[model samples]
Each structure stands twice: as structure tokens, then as C-alpha cells.
Target: MKKSISKVLLAAVTSAVMLSSCSKTPDESRYIPKTAGVVVDLNAKQLTTKLVTNGITMDKLFEATQSKDTSNEVMKAWKDAENSGIDMQSHFFASFVFQGQPAEHKSYISLTASLKDADKFEAYLKKNIANFSLKTQNDFKYIWEEKQHAVIGWNKSAVIYISAVDPSNLEKYNPGGSSSPDYGDPSEPMIDSATAVTDSAMAIPAALTTAEDDAQIKTWVAEVDHLFHLKKDETAGSIEPFAKLLKEDADAGIFVNPEAIYNSGQFTMIPANVKKLMEGSFYTGTVNFENGKIVFNGHSYMGKELAAIYKKYGKKEIDMDMLNKYPSQNITGFISYAFDFRMIGDIVKATGMDGMVNLMMGKSGLSMDDVLNAFEGQLTYVASDFAITKKESPYFPGEFTEKPDAKWIFSLKVGNKDAFNKIMTSPMLKEVFTREGDHYTVVNPMAAATMPAMSINEKFVTLGSDSALLQEYLGGKGHIKLPDGIEGKIKGSMLGGYVDLEKVTAVIPEDKMDEDEKPVAKKAKELLKDVTFVSKADGGDVQHGEAVLTFKNKDQNSLVQLINLGTEAAKVMQARKAKEKAYEDSLFAAPVDTTVVAPQ
Candidate 1:
């Protein structure tokens, strides 16, 4: 079974590679079934252009990685197909579609690619058909079993390979599912009819209501018949929402419908909590590349219930000026988000989770609002600096300098000092912390030695690994210093962070890395040495976020650096793997002593 599946996989890979090398662009919508749960569209020409611009062309990469000795027939055939007069400029489209309902659900994966020369492509498949476990029916060739089913077909300039699955059969492959014999009688009722009904009125529990096995089996059979007998131009039904997204020109993009999954009833046993969350939201995301970053923007449209909840709580703008207090120039990165604590209480009150929260608060002799109001709801996290410190080794003989530890500081503005003070001076904190002036340190034997000590000032509290760093912050010397153009990035953002890649990468000591890892790390360090990232997000009618990577040398932008870095990293990894393989071969090839020694 494994070997058969492997052959199918090999054929699929070869088909994709061969089709990718073709130049003809066929109508993508023809092969796309309307019932598709996800649709992926690839603009091969655009992607190839981008990759070539960055010195990481896919064709060259594949040629470079091709094995020298093609001892395997399947591989040799594939190489021939690739080398054959095929155009390598075309778009590719793939779709995942469901054909049946729950209990006996089935799915199909369809791939469509354009062919430069239909005659040559067909000949290639015919020559290599035996390499896969395939059977012929008319013009189509198919491979089907308990685990997987696949179909391959072509028409003129269009080529398609589809892999389908009967999800009901997956139970046979599930290792964790119960294999025990079923002692329950098939005729037994799911619920006692006498107790379930009274005077012709029937009451059914949610768990007891289920489609009978026989009914599900019939549905599965019907679906299978329909699938096998599908017309060449039959419309499976299009998910228009996702199809519309494809209209936007992009190098590549994907669309998924969670609501469709929820409605399928195929996996009806979704958790209650997740069901509520899923039913309360609709989401879609799009991808596009900018000058430096691969842009991803998404929207979560709340259902009536969730939307009402958001409308009740409202939103607030965070003051970026507050960010000036933290030592920005000294810190590698910092993330700060502002919220109104009362809004959280309001949300909990509006939502149904307040009952449990109130119960827990009552047990602690506190009100829910009081607990929520302890902090001002403005939170800042500072990753100031890092150090590679040596420690005793447990696995090896000598101590080795491990990875760097980021010096982090967390500051929270206090709204109610009285409430916070009471909690801070509680018996629990007294047991864990020892006070000196306005600061406290962990004196507990169980606490990690690296745990930060904390200090409290009027209307503010700060915690840091180093007391001096916290002092610097209190003295206003630890505030983040925004770069010249950074103000523009953070202007309307509710939450933002700045990452100094140069400083962060400088802390990564390549000299301390293992011999095999040093080269890879060195390449990464060199590539990212001048890159810095600033990301910001805003909350309103439509939530928006943007992250931009800035380079010291304008010529070496994020996209170019990323491509070059990936190329170099791949080379390093390939070299390391080759070296490891050679070592293994040498060990295995060592001559064995065949001489029998005389007994003493």
C-alpha cells in the first residue's frame, strides 16, 4: 500500500514539474469545481520574474539540484519530460472540493496547468504510466484504493491531475480509534423510544440525534456514482466569495471558507466553545508583495452576535507619546498596546462568561471590576539587550556558551494604586518577594535565579532582569528614541513595535556556533545585519496593520535580502547534508576483518 501511494506521489510530483515547465496558459476556471473549499492561483510568470530579479530563479535552482546519476527509471523519464520542448511560462491553479455530506464525506484535489505541446505531454504520460498504479477507462487513467483515489486527464492545451479521497475510509487508517468489537445490537435504538416520547410528543437530546449508518452508506454510494459519472462541463457549484478574490492580480494567493467547513456537517462533533466562535465570525485574507515586505491583510467580519458585542465595548486610541518614556534607542524591540480595562469588564458583562468570572472573584473577596481596574490597561514590553552567558554543562564535559538571553522589561501603568498595593502586599507576595526600598526580589528557593526583580513607583510599576535597567527607565533615560521617519509609521496605530535587526543579529555570535551551523548563521547574520522592522496596527471600523522592513543600504531591501539569504542558506544546508552523507558512506564502506583469530 505504501509503495503504491509512493508511486502516485512520484507521478504527481513529476506531472507538476513537467506542467510547470510548459508555456501555454489555459482557462483556469474550467477545471475549478464550484464546491471548492479552498482555491490557490499561481501567476508563474510574475513569480519567475520576481525570483529572477532576486537571483533565485526556480528553473536554475531545480537544474542545480538535479541528481547527477539518474539510476531510477521514473526519475529519468521525468528528466526527459522536463528537457523536452516545453514552455516554462504559465499559470497554475489548484482547488480542494467536497463532494458529499458528513458521515460519508469525500474530497477531491484538482490541479490544472497549461501545456505548451499537448502531443509531447500526452506521450510523456503514456510512456511513464506504468510507473504508477493506474488503470485506464476511456481517455482517463485512475488510481483508487481504500486510502486514496486519483484521476489524470488532459484536453488540448489543458492538463489536469486530480486526487480524491473517501474520508469515511480514514477510520481504518486511524491508529488511535477503538479497534474493539462492537457488542451493541444494530437494531438497538439510539435512545429509549418509550422514555424519549410521551403522548406522540418526542424529545430528542442533541447527542442522540444522528443519521443512521444505513442512510449514510446510501448517501456515500450515491455520491460515488455521481462523481464517477460527472459530465465534462458539469458545474459543481462555485464558491463565488473565494472566486472573486482571485480577480485581484497577485503573484499567488489562497482562499479558504471556514463557514463552509462548519456547515458541511461532515465533522459535526465540533466542540461547543469552538462552534460558538466559528458561528460568530466570517474571515478572509489576501496576500500581495510590496517593495520590501510580502503584504498580508485580513478582515474578520463579526456575525450579528459578535458584532453587537464589539459595538457595546467600543475602542480607544493609544497615545504614542507614552512610548517616549521607554528607552527605544537602547532596546532591540518593544511592543506596546493600550486598552481600557473597564471595556474588558463591560465585554465580560455583555458576554456569557461573566458568571464564572464573578464566582471566582467572589471567592477571592474581590469584585470583577476591581480586579480588572488594578492596571491602567496600557502595557509595554521591552527587549532591551541580550548576552550569551556561560553555565555548567549537563550533557557534555566542558561548559559551552549557549544562546543569548534577552534582557526584558515589562511596565504597566497603574490606575488604582490602592487596589494594586493591597494585592502587592498580600501574604502570597510577602512569601515570594523580599523588599529593599521600593523594589522586591524573589527570595524563594524554587524561583529561577534569572527571574527579574520588580519595582513600584507612583502610578507605575516596572519589572526587569537587571535592577539598573529598571532604574534607568524610572529616571526617563530608558525611553525608546524613535527614528526620523518612525513617527509616520506609528501615527494612527493602536499598537506598534520596532525591531532593530542589526542589534539583534549582532548579539548572535556565529563564532560560538557549532562548525556545521556557523556557516549558515554567518550568512543569515550578514543578510539581516542592516534590516530593521517597524509594524503598526489600528482599530476602527476596519482594522488595519502594516509592517515595513528598512535596510541601511537602500539597494539591499527586505525582499532582495530575503531571496539572497534563502539562496545562501539552501547552499549551506545542501553542503552540510552532503558532508554528513559522505561521512556515513565512509563509515559503512570501511573494510571488515574476515580473518578468524586463534583461540587463546
Candidate 2:
């Protein structure tokens, strides 16, 4: 029982997070309060939005480090960074390298970022990078683009020189060696006789929030809202369906102010860490939220175009006022709205037998996320049932599940082959399924992904809580299967009857126990004897891991002194041997016999 429950709980969480064959809250009201001031800065290794004076916030700082702004003084000094040669749109990965030594008075730090999309993603990147340059004047050029690059060299402190022009004097003053005119691979060879910084100066980003910062973030939020429009409507083809709620005698007061989210005055820019939380940083749209509506207005550059395409395929505009009324005598208007209206009613309406079927699905007491997720999981199911209409149900999986242990399994499916394949191939869908977080979202077909949609769709999104809506539609066998007093316990989360935990736990028979039966459990107990279940919820397995970095650091000054004293100290002796081996390898035919080993 416990094992089954554990699997059920975990699968439930995964299924809920992923799309399912369920209805989710169509409203965005409840989610807004959660976003307030929650900025997770991923680069800094911090998971928070609280502004600190000393630290930098990537949400605002990346643009500064990514772009060339003369107004900033520290940035102006770092000329190469101004034109780091990497395109911002295409730059998504950051490579970190630690160079040189601290005691030798030569230290360096560099971060490289990239933005490559789809197939051969990295090779496409390598071909686009630039040659590395090291000048005798303590200058370096690491630009990956055509021509222009940067070089750094240091004597007292590090000095970096950047050149768009070959004749620029920045690389003229030699520091380490004779000059090399070659512009070859940056990593191929450190152009012999080329300059080295003999010194170091590290670069860091500027400040985090400024006063002007607040204004810009607000503008960003507003722009996200405008593109995703919301239609204030509930058209369940049968006015008779909402009979109880719409009747003159019944207590059907409209829930006009469904919910007002984002009114908390607690809001902050989306966190830099949001990317790390996602399975992949790449996403389909720019997401934000308004009062009652959570808007995914699409990417600023791609939102309008993508949404227009969806609209073109999914809907045609119609008379908004004629949406919800009982038995409207106008047959022409009704049919027009049915075909011409946005495909929204296709998702959540009470019109016709199908809408009633869906309405029953929504009000079945399953949480909205779970319902929507089932659909996402079985897109094949929905598409198969609704789209192209395949002939049969698997009723059973055909691949791996039937075998005792197998390599494959069939998941749910929707028959919309095109949409089905698109989802299957999407990195975003993989992310939505495997990566955990508040990542999966659904939107109204007609409603724009904006704040206004919040007010309009609030009722639909928050339907899980509206017992009244469910109650109004309940009539036939599909209405609900509640026992005598089950309706009273529905909110209490009783599955079907008046059972409680006390009565449930009483039925645990010793013979039915699996925990003591599985040997793996015995071995797990031994392994977990010292290891902690670091993050257990509901008495479940814990997740934990550790990191380790080990390196050998030797003081070369001791070797230098011994050499000057004409004495072979153990350290100097070792250094000489190491240096000899390095030289031998530098001129080697093959040093496969020499292996790099970790210290014991």
C-alpha cells in the first residue's frame, strides 16, 4: 500500500506538473501573488530577488555586460568587453576559465556566453568563433567574430588592449616577449614571443538596481500584457446548462470580481535564476502576469507573429454580446458564434453534449493542473479523440508495459499529428515534463495573454473551487457519483465515502507489507544509515548530493630561492623534474605513457 501510494504520489506530482487529461483553472487570479519580489539570481548562485547593494542582479546586469554603453565608466575601460564579439541573441551558454597564478602576480578570469539553437548546435557555434591573440604589450584578443579582438598583459597591474585597427598603439608596448603578427587560432599556440600580461586585472559587472531600473521593468511588464487579449465570455451552447446560476429564482449572483491578483504591490523583475530552474533556458514565449491573468505574451520579438498564426488557424471573431444566454431564439447568430468564435469554447464551455462532457471533466473534483497535464501527457489522446479522430483506444499500452521488464512504453497521445509531432520534438515539451517547477501553463484560445485577460477569464481558471458551477451542471449520471453524505465531505478531499485516516490505517495487514519484503529496501536502509533524507515531503525519499574540487598548489618562490642558493631542495628538485617532463611533452612524439593522476 505504501509503495503504491508513494508511486502514485510521485506520478501524481509529475502528472500534475506535466499536461494531463484534466481541466485546469482557466483564470490567472490565484497565481499573481506568488510572483511578488521573487527574483532568483542564477549566476550569483543565489535564489532570491532581494536587492543587495554589493552584489549584481543578472536580470539588469547582463544587458550592461552584454552591450556597450559609454555612460558607464567601468565598462568604458574594458574596451574588448564592449565588443565581446558574441551576439547577444545567439549567446546563451557561458564558459568559465581560470588562468594564471596569484603569487606570480598574474591572474585572469574570463566568461564566454552563447546562444545556439537546434542540431549541430555546438559545431555551428565553433565555426563562428574568432582567433585568439596575445601581444607582447600585455594585450589579448579573444574576439570570436571577424577581425577586431582583445589582448591583455600586466606588469604593475594588468592592462588590456583592444583593437578594431591593426595599427592601434594599444598592442605596441611589449611586456613579455617579441611580437607575433599571426592571427591564428586563439588556443592553438600562445604566439611565441607574443606578449603576456605578466600581471592581472579581473573584470566584474557594475551595480544592480538603479531608480531608472524600476521604470523600465514596469514598461516591460505592460508591453507583455497588451498582446494577449482576454475575451470576457462563458458560452456553454446551452443556456439551460447554467440554469441554476442564471435563473431569476436561484441564487446565481455572478462572481463578477472572480479574483484580483497582482494587487499586492509586491512585484519584481523575473529572476535571472528562472532559466536554471527550467530544464533548458530556451522557451517559446516571454511570460508575465497581470491582476488576475498570467500572460505569456510570447517573446517581445516573436510574440505577435506566433500568436497571429495560432489565431488564424484556431478562430474567427464574432458577436461578443450574444455569448451566454438561455435559449436565445437566434439560430443564425448561435451557429455563427459556434464556428466563428475563438476555439476557446472548445476547451471550456458548457454548450452542446461535448461541452457538457468537458464541463463534467473539469468539475470532477480533480485539480486543474492534473487535468490539463493528463492532456499534455496524452496529446495523442485528445488529438486522436478530437482532431483527426483515430478509430480506437489502446485501452492498454502496446509496447513495454505488457512485458515484465521492457525497454519501451506507450504514453498517452492526441491525434493531431502535426501538433502531436511538434510537441514530441520540442525541447520545451521535454522541459515541461521532466524539469520540475511552475513551468506548465495553459491559456484561453481567444484571450490575449495579458492583464485584461485576468479579469475576464478569472472565473474559468478558478473553476476547481466553484462547487456552485459544478452543482448547477449536475443532472445526469455523469454529474457526480456521490454517496448519501459524500457531497459534504468533497471539500475535505474524501475520495468517495466517509473514510478517514484513522479508519484507513486500521486495515494495514502485516502479510500485505512490501517494505520488509524488498531486499533493496534492506540495502537502502544500510546506505541511508548515515545519509540524510535532505528534502523529504510526506515521508518520501530524499534528494541530496555533494561537490568536491581538489588541486595541487605549490609555492614556486621556494624553488626559485633554492636555485639561486645553488641548493637542490626537495621542492626545487621536483620543480626541475616537472619542468623537464613538460618540455619533453612539448616536443614529444607521443607522451601516452605519462598520465595525469590525482593525488592519493
Candidate 3:
């Protein structure tokens, strides 16, 4: 299975990965062993099961929905969102549409726990999860039943919730859901329907009833909210390890059966292609119970096969109805305020999502958004362990047959939180995910034998401030530097390199002294002329990827010109789509602030 995982990764990165011709050693071959991973079909039944676990039964779910506080808060949040400027009700579109029926998603849960108890839970979670490390621990989340409320924490502000719909239901509304996927399911304990319980120890929830409690739930709700939000006084920086694990579990990475491809005959040529037509893709794990079994279904996918297949049939140009047939991988993923299909999805469909985002980001005609959306369709295979293969050189006959000191098994994905947790425990990932607290860490271990994962967070600093890149290996974070005494800033970032060069421009800083150019700007009577600039190894102007700011400084002003030596420009606005998606996903984290500031 591990070999097969390596093979699939090799296939996924064939074009992007760099290969070597090193000789294989017997010790190295013996080192590679079967990895410890859990893979299950996150089928429809499984998904539905996890959602309504004994802790949250169907009746309890609806009842919670009916609770006065829940209904009131949801209504208030809904109305505030509706009445506010952004209209998720319409002016929004998700990159990935889970259920095509245009369903509205909203979660209302509250939790409170002591710092000591929270730490215990976090430690407990780290102990349970294999490969758990302190460096990556922050990436995990924990959900605990506290007397105050049901606590869920990760990093700083973690909040886990349950949401999703059936694939069949998605096909029912969106014509573009033909490509719907089943990510993976929970194992061992039945994927039973979990009823939500407010007691500690996750006690079984009470029976359903047509009765109402006289105890002021509203007062309690306010206090709980205060504890988590306003009264955050001391709890603000506290770390809840269990909350962390719960949050990590909420991520799409864990739900993927990271071993699917190896199990597929086409990729490994070893494992018999079991007759399973549908394999779950990517999803947030569910902890529901049904018929005494727990299951899962709602999630996202790499959509490699589905997208390849869908595009082969020209599904991109097809309508929503065709989307129903689309692997219909969820598209346009972001926190939506409300459900308004026509204004959000339809309008964007007409104008092109990528193009619109580019325009929103002050650039036009940039297809980066499109490229990213498409990229998601691919990388799916890379998520598995056996997708990458090593020891295939003719120099060694008994390559993989032997082994070495310790086998190198790359993680499909590991955020700094989990990396931190792992760091606290596992020495392997700790050496890698070492960034420190407050801001957090990131560790993208390459699952491929030939390819290394993009080094995650080789630097750490305040969220809004600049941080120096530490590792020479990491691709490094986005950089924007301003020229000395110039009215323009030089900024650029590494893309998978899909940036649209034409749109990459240096914006003239208005704060600088541009008195000379001021006249040129005011008397701009002539048509815009294309001025070619020359590239400088040290201090020359840019021509090819370079350009000179030709403001008429007839007398040659301080040469305070704007130069776009920066990398290409694409829709960098949605670059935080994944992080932001995690923010919206109460499972991983939550909006600590009232509003999330756009990622620079």
C-alpha cells in the first residue's frame, strides 16, 4: 500500500516534481514499511451517521435548531448578514458546491472549559492520534463537554460544527453535481447517530420532548458567549489540545482515505481493483450515530479523476443542470451569508469566477482563480501515501525489497498546529514544524519520495508584520518590498507560477513626495503611451519582466518610479481561500474577530 501510495504521488507530481538518479541501497529498501493509516469509504450512510451521533440525534438536531437561543441567534446573524453590505443570500458563490440544491449552512454552538481541563483534553487527544507532534499539535482541535457549555478549541479560537448534504440531494438541485464524491468514513465504533449532550463526559443526550425548560437558557447563552468572546480576558491565549485535535479532524485532509489510489489497480498494478464504483473524496469527519453505527459523507475532493473526466466531456462550459452530472466537486467555497443562487453563482458563472475575483483584486483578465480551481481537480492523488515510488533504478535489483534505519513516510498534509502537537510528542515532525506560538506554524511534508512538500512557515512573526524566511528549502512566503525614496512598492510572491505577468504592477505609494509627477498627473492630456524599461542586474530598469515608471519628470525627478520587478499578478485575493474556509468551518477554527480582515 505504501509503495502504491508512492506511485500515485509520483504520477500526480510527474510534471511538477524533480527526480534523482541516486543508487538504491538494501538497508534503505528494508526501511520502507507499511504506514499506519486509516482508510474507509466515507459513503453516504457513513457521513449521515457521523453527523447525528448519539450525542446529536435527528430529533435533537432539529430541536436544537428550534431552541429559542439558536433560532434567535441564527435569525439575528442571518438578518445582520442580509441587512449588512455582503449578501450571501445572493452575491456569493462557493468554489466547491457540496450539495447542489443551494442549501444554506449555519452552525450555532457554544462551549466553555477551564484552562487546566482544556490542556488535559488536548494532551489526551495528542496521545490518541498516532504521529501526533507538538509542533503540529496546534493544528488539531478538541471538543469537550464542560458544565458551562460544549467547548471546542484549536490554536486561538477553535469551533467545531457539523454540516453537509447527501450526494443524491445535491444532484437533485444542481445540474452540475454529476461529479459528487464520497470522501471517507470513520472506523471501529459504529458511525452511530450522536445526539448533542450538554453534560461532561459526553453523556448520552436526553430523550426528545414537547416540553420547554424554564431555566433561562438565554442568560446562560450570554454568559457562555461572554466567556468565549468578550470575557476572553484570560482564556484568550489559552491552548486547548483536545480542541485542537477536533479542529484538525474538521479539516478535509484527515477525512481523505489517503490510501485510496494504491488500493486502486490502475495506480499500483498490485492491489486488485475492488469493485467499488464510488470512493469518498474530501470531507469534514462526522460523529453521528444511526442504527447504532456511525458514518460520514459530506466533504470535498482533489477531484483529479472527476475533473479530468468532467473536462474531457466539456463540463466547464456546461450549465448548472450539467453540474448535477459533474463530479460537481464543490466550487466557490467561502463563508456564505445566505443562499442566493441567481445573484451569486449565476452572475459569477456569466462573468467567469476567476475573472471577477481578479477584478475585485484590482487586476483584470487574470485566470489565476480559474487555474487554482482547476488545480484542485488534480493533487487528489498526491494526498495518498503510496502515490510516490522510490528505488526504481536499474542500478539496484532488490531495491524496495530491502530497507534502512527508518522509513521516510511523508504526511499527506500537516498544519503547524498538528505539527506543533507532534513536536511536543514526535521528534520527527517537531524538527520540521518548529515555528513557535502566538502566530502558529506550518509543515507541508512531501508525500512523494522524489518530491518534497512546500516547506511550510519557514518564518514566524506577528500576523500583520513581515517575518524573515528561515529555511533555504522553503519556497518562502509572499514578499512585498518598497524601493528606498520611491513612491512605489516592489512586491511579488511565488505562485505554483501560474500568475499572469501582465497584471503584476507596482503601485505608486501616495505617501511619498511626488510633487514633480503631480504636475504630470494633473496635465495628463496625452494618450497612455507604452514606455519600455530595461532590466537591471543591480540597479537598472526592467524591460522584459521590467518596466520604467514614465511619469513626465521632464527634468528627471528623483527617479521615484514604480517598478514591477515583483512576480506575476493573479487573484491573490482568494489566496487565503483554504485558510478562510477553515475559519468558516467551525470545526477547525472560528472568527475570533467580528469580521475577518482580508489576507494581504
Best-performing candidate as measured by lDDT: 1
Candidate with better lDDT, 1 vs 2:
1
lDDT of 2 by residue, 163-253 (tens): 2221122253223224533322332212111112111101111133355544533332232221112132322112221222222211001
Model 3's number of clashes is 147
Where does the lowest 10-residue lDDT sum fall in candidate 3?
559-568
TM-score of each: 0.67, 0.16, 0.16
Clash counts for the predictions, in order = 15, 56, 147
lDDT of 1 by residue, 1-600 (tens): 012222333333333332211222235545565455566666556555655665654444443343233124334433464543233445566666655564444565666665677667555544433333334444443332212234454545555555544444545423344641121221222112211222122222223424663354334343333434455444322434444455555555566656555555555666555456445343445555445455555545455545555556566545564567665466667777776687667656655577789787664556677667788787777786655667767777686756667777788788887676666655546666665665555667568365666776546677876877677767775557665666566555556676777777777766656676777687666554222233332333334444455554445334455655555565566666677777767667767754433221
Would you list the C-alpha lDDT of every candidate in the order shown? 0.52, 0.22, 0.24
Q: Tell me the lDDT of model 3 at 8.
A: 16
Q: On residues 250-281, what C-alpha lDDT tens digit does candidate 3 reach at each position? A: 21112233333234222333322221212322
